[model samples]
Target: LHHLKTKRTEVYQDSSPFMSYSGCCCVLLPYSKCCYVLLPYSYRCYVLLTYSYLCYVLLSYSYRCYVLLSYSHFCYVLLSYSDCCY
Candidate 1:
């Protein structure tokens, strides 16, 4: 029992700093068959997910702007041609 307690304390001491740095809450779940370390929603995970989403949004907006600009330029050229022909 003493050895098991010491081992658990060591695990917490080793994992706490790393978990805190990443803004995660670490939980030790002991089941009848096994033990698992659960890390709930870390800031690093959120940042990575959000970064991809942000990149996607920026790319979509940039493509939209490029298309709108092309359309506007095409309309301008048509107007200029009509004026010249008239």
Candidate 2:
């Protein structure tokens, strides 16, 4: 139904291999006899994939986050110190 929508849903099959489904799509499970569906406009579900796999997080991916934080702190310190000095 249109009221029910999910993202990156894991449809488990006892005998078959696992699959990751995502991206507002749908497929039929011939053996299990049910349709695996995903909705695109879903708010909870984001970044869906339709393959047997996993989600890997790159540690270095947050480098820019660290830089942004450091820059913000630097600016705050500079402004506060200037304010105090003046």
**What range of 10 consecutive residues in model 1 has the weakest lDDT sum?**
77-86
**Residue clash pairs of candidate 1:** none
TM-score for predicted model 1 compared with the true structure: 0.14
- Tell me the RMSD of model 1 versus the true structure: 25.1
Q: Residue by residue across 1-86, what tens digits does model 2's lDDT show?
A: 11223343564433333344444323333233232212224512112223223221111122111111122223211111110111
RMSD of each: 25.1, 19.1
Q: After superposition, how far is residue 41 of candidate 1 from its true place, in Å?
A: 10
lDDT of 1 at 10: 26
